[model samples]
Target: MHRWMDGVIGALLVLLVLVGALRWVDTTWRPVVVLQSVGPFVVIGLGLLFVGTLLLHRWWMLLPVGVCAAVAWAMALPTFFAHTVPGPANFTVMSANLYYGRANADQVMAAVRAHEVDVLVLTEVTPDVVDRLDTAGLTRLLGHRAGEAHADTFTGTMIYSRLPMTVVSGTANPAIEQTPSLQPEVVLTVDGQQVRLKAAHPMAPIPDQTAQWRAGLTALQRWKGDVPAGDRLVLAGDFNASFGHPGFRQLADGLVDAQRTAGQGWVRTWPVVGRRMPPFVALDHLLSRGLGVVKAGDVAFHGSDHMLVWASYTLR
Candidate 1:
């Protein structure tokens, strides 16, 4: 019976290694993408399993488990170290999902005011929610705005800025077709510099929506690649994809993840309010280029399942 249990444990460990491997491959399959979202946790589990193999005297399983754990750790280690470029943090940005317009407007405004946020990216915004936000003094604070609110569905994305901004149509990427949610891009004039910003909320990779999710991220990658190397760009929102997803990694290639740059290790930003379980994966992100990250972190609000992700940056 002990031998059989050891065999079962070894098999589970092997399966986990396969799941961890998904971080390097692109796939639109629902299960694989879902598992990949928790890549950091998979590395942790792999480490624990490697220890278990030794503690249980499963010598035959030691080599495989140890090697896989080492590989996973090697890949994940860099994300924990600060890569901040030296500069004064003159700009602050925040992204939040409104839980289909259910998130408390007062709480959201309070966060904006507290952070002295220069720009705000919002997802799942509805017409009524926009009114509530204005009522809560959002317009008085930020003033400039772009993107339209959806009256019938949670398809709206908007960028609000204290600096002057105008909505710009994204370069049409054929790779993105029929995506379920709206991703709005705008150009903000900051200190005589033009900074392009996108409020991005790609479709979630649930069972039937996996293909659209993949396309949405692919579109983002193409959009990022098309930007001139010298241009400043920022993409912020509930991406619905993590670093584990190869598509996300591709999109993030030339950009910096604010949280990673600040070395906020394994920060999770979803399911903070309505779920039975604690937040396990980070679906929200702030990715940028031509900006020096000074600090970054997440904030809990009253009603949204997603925590607000904010980052401070300087011109690079």
Candidate 2:
């Protein structure tokens, strides 16, 4: 029985490593192996595997066991620590995937106006929803706004800001043949500085993960780096890539994870259900380049399975 138990635990660990490797390999691979909300399972399973090995007879395997523990611990490093900011001039930035719910958005919009978000970013926005928000007086709540609701739902993304944004450019993706219009980028000016605010929801890693999903990351990075090193930049959305991967590190090359830099806890913002927040795997992020993070947290939740990300920042 003990031998079988050991075998079971060992197999699970091996499975975890393989899953991590696959996540590293590609995004479309997301669906092939993991179906829905796999981040929490991965985090919990790895932790249990490490703990279960302690009672086994083959304790010599402890060396590798320790390595697994350390690796899992490191994967959580980005959001492992919570940060606090000390200041009087505070501005909060929040983002959420609307899921095109007008009624639900009434709650989301009310929350945004009450909080007085400096810049609000949203994706998965439909034409009717946009019109509803317009009629609901979001332009006044935001103090300024830009971008038209898509007529056909090709790209449903928009950024509402209190500082009045100027559309620098929106990338339509010449590389993608299908779903090419979904991801786009925009530039905004706040406090006399141009901040590139990009909202992207790339296709899940299914067919040709690297070429397909990574292409979206590439597009975001292209628009991001378009600005000079001396400007403020904010990249927010569901990056699909979880902990311990190069895909996120690739984006972190010049930007700072806002949750890691200023959050007060492991800011896990996915699978937001029943007012119960889970911190298993960190998705949804508020990242900035050449900007200082002041305040950030899982700011809001409603329709989608993903939570919203909000943070206050200053141009440095």
lDDT of 2 by residue, 14-91 (tens): 887666555454444445334323544565667766677776655755566668767766765645565544543335
Q: Which sections of candidate 2 miss by over 4 Å?
A: 26-40, 56-58, 83-85, 101-103, 151-154, 170-179, 182-186, 206-210, 243-245, 263-267, 271-283
Off by over 4 Å in 1: 170-177
Task: Write model 1 residue lDDT over 136-204, tens digit each, in one string.
Answer: 999999998877777655677778899888778532233463355677788888788888998787788
Model 1 lDDT on a 0 to 1 scale: 0.85
Which residue pairs clash in candidate 2? 27-205, 28-205, 28-206, 83-263
Of candidate 2, the 10-residue stretch with the lowest lDDT total is: 28-37
Worst 10-residue lDDT window, candidate 1: 169-178
